[model samples]
Target: MPTITIKNIPEELYEALKSTAENHHRSINSEVIIRLEQALLPRLKTPKDKLTNIQRLRAQISPNVISADDIDDIINNGRA
Candidate 1:
């Protein structure tokens, strides 16, 4: 196993990492390794796969419950 040292981590970031490690019952080093793996490795999804997921989620929503006007109003309200 290789050992490395990280220098000059921001106080807030270090605290956040420490808190997350404690919450998940892991040591800081383990938490860092898990986070690094997630950052470096990602799952590849095809366009068809993504579209299928979108369609599945959209199918769960009831039809005609909210009108287009309601959606527009919701969007405009957020801008004010």
Candidate 2:
């Protein structure tokens, strides 16, 4: 394993990180690694990915739903 030093961390931020690390049962070093990974990781979602999500959601919905006008009226009424 490699070692890295992070310098000039603000007092408030350091305390928050220390608190979070203790709560998660991780050392400060481990907490920093976990937080860095979460911040750096990129989530890729294509159109196909979105389509699959839409299909899944649609499948769970019942047929013979209310008309668009009815939905619009309901939305407009909510603003009043």
lDDT of 2 by residue, 1-75 (tens): 888888899999999999999999999989999999888985688999999999999999998689889999999
TM-score of 2: 0.51
Can you list the residue pairs that collide in candidate 1?
A: none
TM-score of 1: 0.55
TM-score for each of the candidates: 0.55, 0.51
Best by TM-score: 1
Q: Rate the local accuracy (lDDT) of all candidates.
A: 0.97, 0.94
- Candidate 1 lDDT by residue in tens digits, 1-80: 99999999999999999999999999999999999988898768999999999999999999999999999999999999
Q: For model 2, what is the C-alpha lDDT against the true structure?
A: 0.94
**Model 2 misplacement above 4 A:** 43-80
